[model samples]
Target: MNPSFAQASPQALVAGDPDQGAVLDAALAPLRAEFGTVDLVVERMDRLGNWAFVIGDMRSPGGGRLDMSGTRFADAAEQGAMSSVYVALLRREGDAAGDASDAATESTAAGAGPAAPAEAAARDQAGLQQEDADPAVAAETPRGRWVVVDFAIGPGDVAWLGWPQEHAAPRALFGF
Candidate 1:
C-alpha cells in the first residue's frame, strides 16, 4: 500500500475510489471484459459523472490514450443506457484501431451486468436484499459500494474495481 493512499481515512478508501486502483478494480472489470487484452484502464479523473474529466491509458495494441473529457457516457447513463452506450463507443474504437483480435475475445455470457446504468438505478436493490449467502458481504456491501449511482457514474462510481464491483453494481451501486 502506498503511504500517500494510507494517509487517507479508511472509510474514504472503502468508497468506490478510482485513485486507489486495487480497491477500484472490482468496479472496472466489466469494462475490462470488453477490452480483452487491451489495457484500457482509467488512470485518473477530476470527477466521475456525466461531465467528468477522465484520463486513462489506452494501450489498444496500437498504444494510445483515452483523452475523453466531455464525452457522452453521462448522457447515456441518464437514459439508463450507459452500459450499451459505453460498450458501443468502445467497440467503435476497437474496430477503428484494428483491435479485432482482442475485441473478439469478449464474451456474451451471463452476469454481464445491466444493459444500462439507468435500469440499475431504477431498481436499486442494495440494502433491500437480505437473503444473500454471505452475511458479512450482505451487511457491508450496501454501506459504500457503488459504480452506476443515480443513473450514471458520479463521485461514487468505481470504474476501477474488478469482481466485487461488478457484482455489487447491479445491486448496491444503483441510485444516488
Candidate 2:
C-alpha cells in the first residue's frame, strides 16, 4: 500500500489529491448531470501503475440511494444500491506529448456522447468492443490514451465481464 493512501481518510485521500479528484469528477460527470447533487461515500480505493479504481455509493441529499441497470451492471433496476466502481487511467498532460490531450479534447468537444453507429462499428472492428471487452485490458493496449474510462456501479458478484475487476481493488494492489 502507498503509505500516503493508507494513512489518509477516504474523503481526505480523494479531496487532497488533484489527480484522483480530476479523474473521479470526470468519471462521474454524467451521473452528476443526471442525478443532480448527490453524496459519494467511498468504500475502497486502489492504485495501479497510472490506473485507479474507486469503489463507492451514491446517495441523494435526502438520503435516497441510486442503482445501476443495463446490460452492463445490475441487469435490472430492482437489484438496488450495490456499490459503484469508477476506473480511471491517468496520464499527465505531457506524458504522451499531446496524444492523450488531443484525444481527450476531441472527446470533450464531442460532449462525450455515445458514438455514432459507424464509429461504434469501427471501434469494435478495431478491437475496442466497449460492451464486451474487458475495459482494463482495452485501456492497456496501444490506446493507453484513455484518460477516464468512467464508472461502473454494481456488486462484485455481478458478471461484469466487461470490467472483470468490478468492485474488487485492482489486482496490482495485491502485487499481481
Candidate 3:
C-alpha cells in the first residue's frame, strides 16, 4: 500500500440521504459505461454522512468479470473527480470503454501501448508468472478503494481534516 494513502473506516463515513439512489446512479454512469454495467452495493455510510457505495462484480460478454468498488458523491465536483479516477484506472490499464481504436491495434501488435510495458515490467519485477492480460482481469483488479469524504465538508471545515490526499484518491482507491 502507498504510505501517502489514507481512508476513513466505512463506519466513519455516513450517508445523508438513504434515498439518494438516483443521484448515485447518475454519478456512476461513467463507471457503468466503462465496466459494461455496475451494481451499487451500499456497504456502509461514512463518518461525515455520505453514501459509501461499492461496484459489485460486473460480468462481461467475454466471459470475464470486473470487480470494481468505489464510493459516489452527490456533489457534482466530487462526482466528476470520482468518475475521472475510474476512467483513469481503465485508461491506464488499457481496458476498453468502447473508445480508443489504438487500444486494439496496440493489443494485437507486439502488446505495446501506454500501460502494457509498465504492467509487463511489474510482472517481471514481481517474478510472478505471466497470466493472460485479459480485459476482464484489468477491470476486476481493484486499483484501489475510494471515498467521497471531502465532498460533504464545508469550506471552513476543510482544515479539520488532514491533507486532501489523506482522504482522497490513490489512498481512497485502496480502501485504506
lDDT of 3 at 24: 46
Tens-digit per-residue lDDT, 26-57, candidate 3: 33455555455544333332321122333232
Off by over 4 Å in 2: 1-14, 67-75, 79-146, 155-170, 173-176
Give a tens-digit lDDT track for model 1, residues 17-116: 5333332343344444444444544443332111112234444455653222345444544655433212100000111122222212332132243323
Please identify model 1 stretches exceeding 4 Å from their true place.
Answer: 1-19, 41-43, 46-54, 61-143, 149-176
Worst 10 residues of 2 by lDDT: 1-10
lDDT of 2 by residue, 9-61 (tens): 22223555545555455445545655557566666554453445555567656
TM-score of each: 0.24, 0.45, 0.24
- What TM-score does structure 3 among the candidates reach? 0.24
Number of clashing residue pairs, candidate 3: 17
| lDDT of prediction 1 | 0.28
